[model samples]
Target: MSALRSRKIKYFFILPSIIWVLAFTIFPLFYSLGLSFFKVRLGKPTHFVGLANFERIINDYKLVNSLKVTLLYVAITVTVQIVLGILLALLFHQETKGKSILRALMILPIFCTPVAVGYLGLTIFYEEGGPLNSFLMSLFGAKIPWLSHPTWAWVAVLLLDIWQWTPFCFLVILAGLQSLSEEIYDAAYIDSSSEWEIFRKIALPMIQPVVIIVLLLRLIESFKIFDVIFSLTGGGPGTATEVFSLYTYRTGLRFFDFGYASALSYLLLAIVMIIINLFFKRIRAVYE
Candidate 1:
């Protein structure tokens, strides 16, 4: 009786969380999935359209372009973040003056809200009198359009993502570095191994799990990037900066195309799942 009662009590404690997930997560997901199979627009009777929504998504030019832009953004941001993060981790791992203060300062950008960061990017990258162009103008008497041109707008968004999220990668890698066995490094030194050889052969391998984790997290988050691009560029000058999430938002909210938006979102979800699965499979194969 006591054991049964204890189990019931435990479930009672977890019931709220289960309800929350069902109400906010699972229910909405299933509802969206159902909605994707219909033709739903605001103030209109929804009618079952079978696979029409998905079919339309497959033929969507904006979706295709958004996919390309999203892939490019993810590729550039994740690659740069991982590389720079590891390098920063290694640099900060050394016993140096102001290391603590610098580490504290590094976390500030990560703590700031993404929307705020997007707005900050606007100020920093503004065309006429922004700080970046102002500096360039004074130095070289030239002012490049950071937001007006497609390429520079893309670059501006990329820089904002890198600045905001690199610290997350840095902190993860730094923790990995700190958790490493100093004894192994001491032995390597005793064997007359150079610092480069030690890091290349030992540290890198030891931190593989951390790197993978950081990569997965950054990839997922960057795939869903919207607010930064929305607030910064508003997918402006063209569809050049329209990421997948932003495109979906514009479709559903701005255009009131719920069914199509739902289909697009599911497509994105499937793509993310496939990529994640492939990444894990590759990692497993390599480790095996």
Candidate 2:
């Protein structure tokens, strides 16, 4: 085919993706931004009220609480995932029997859809006769509320998050570790470097980029976490586990306040952008 024709063919193939992004991504972004300036309610005319929705955010106690819990959740889950993930990656990196099988089992959770995992959590954490509760009963004869109460509800959410995402961190971090040459470790050993010393000095610095990437990915996902919480707890027994996304969803859909919901979602976007910016700045500073 001629160059022009070949290029035209490629464009033809790419056209659907371009349209999809425009329709779903770009349009909704600008649309939401515009919507945030309006006072939209069900069965009422939409009227622009400049900065009202954003201003209201300052006094919205529920919104503030949601952000707080969400941040706490992300902080705990991401930290645990990173710390435990690194340990598991290191364990799996060493030669051992049945480790391949253990790695396979660990990563299986990552392959499961968040919704499916949520439902699975529902079963496992059932307070009555559930596997976890039943095991607890057998051992201690007490039923712990897995989906009720603020503290336990938070625990449930964080636990499921840790269970699902830690494997992903392990897999990526392990890949980064495996890329290092054996000669590096042999040299370290020749230098009389202890195992912890090698990890703290050589392995960590080498994998810093990988760890940052994983942190960014997890932060983005955890901030927007909805599927698992929705399927598992539905924002819980009394909104105790409601995160930003869940609150925005309720405001827009359940309460039919699209203006405030749009504003809330935009705020979430801003928070995520800030986080990503800081990470990128750190990454650049490191290289510089």
Candidate 3:
């Protein structure tokens, strides 16, 4: 076949993907962008409102509260997941019996859907006559309310997210760890007497780029956290766990404020874009 024909064949193969993206992704994105600039309601005629919807964000106290909640969740979840994941990855990278079985079990949580995990968490964190409280009650003779209190509700959501996502970080970090050259470690061992020194000087540097990638992915995922919180806490205990995404959802579907909801969603998109760009710039600076 001619080069042009081969190129055409490649494009033909990718045509479906292009069409799918345009239909599902690009179309809805622009549609929502248009919707964000209008006043959309169930029974009312739609009209352009310019920046009216966006302007409400400044005075919206609930929006600020939701943002604070989301930032808190994101900060804690990402930090704990990264630290615990690194430790677990290091532990499993050792030459130990049952390592395969242990690693398999560790990654099992990541395979389960977030909704299912949330439901499972309900069982584990039951306030009255629940397993966790039961155990704590046995130890301290007091049951700490997991779902009923505001602070504990946030804690419950954080725990669920950390439980599910830490393994993902572990998997990625383990892969990066395993990709290192054995010779490099051997040379480092000869030069350094302490294991921490060797790991700090050689192993960590080798896997840092991978860790950065995992951090970026986790940050984005944490910022968009919805499903787990929806099934687990329903963003309740009086809005203690209501992240920004959940609030935006309530604004659109519950309150029937599509224009404002769309504006909130676009704000979230802009925040994510800004975060991603910062990370990208940092990565570029490192490489350049």
lDDT: which candidate is best?
1
Every candidate's lDDT: 0.90, 0.90, 0.89
Query: Which stretch of 10 consecutive residues in model 2 shows the poorest summed lDDT?
Result: 1-10
lDDT of 2 by residue, 29-78 (tens): 99889889999979243798999999999999999889998999999999
Model 1 CA deviation exceeding 4 Å by range:
1-6, 43-45, 279-288
lDDT tens digits, residue span 22-132, model 1: 999989999899888888779252799999998997788989999999999999999999999999999999888998899899999888888888998999998889999
- Which consecutive 10 residues in model 1 have the weakest lDDT in total? 1-10
Clashes of each: 0, 0, 0
TM-score of each: 0.92, 0.89, 0.92
Query: How far in Å is the alpha carbon of 84 misplaced in model 2?
Result: 0.5
Model 3, position 210, has a per-residue lDDT of 91
Instruction: State each model's C-alpha RMSD to the native.
Output: 3.7, 3.9, 3.0
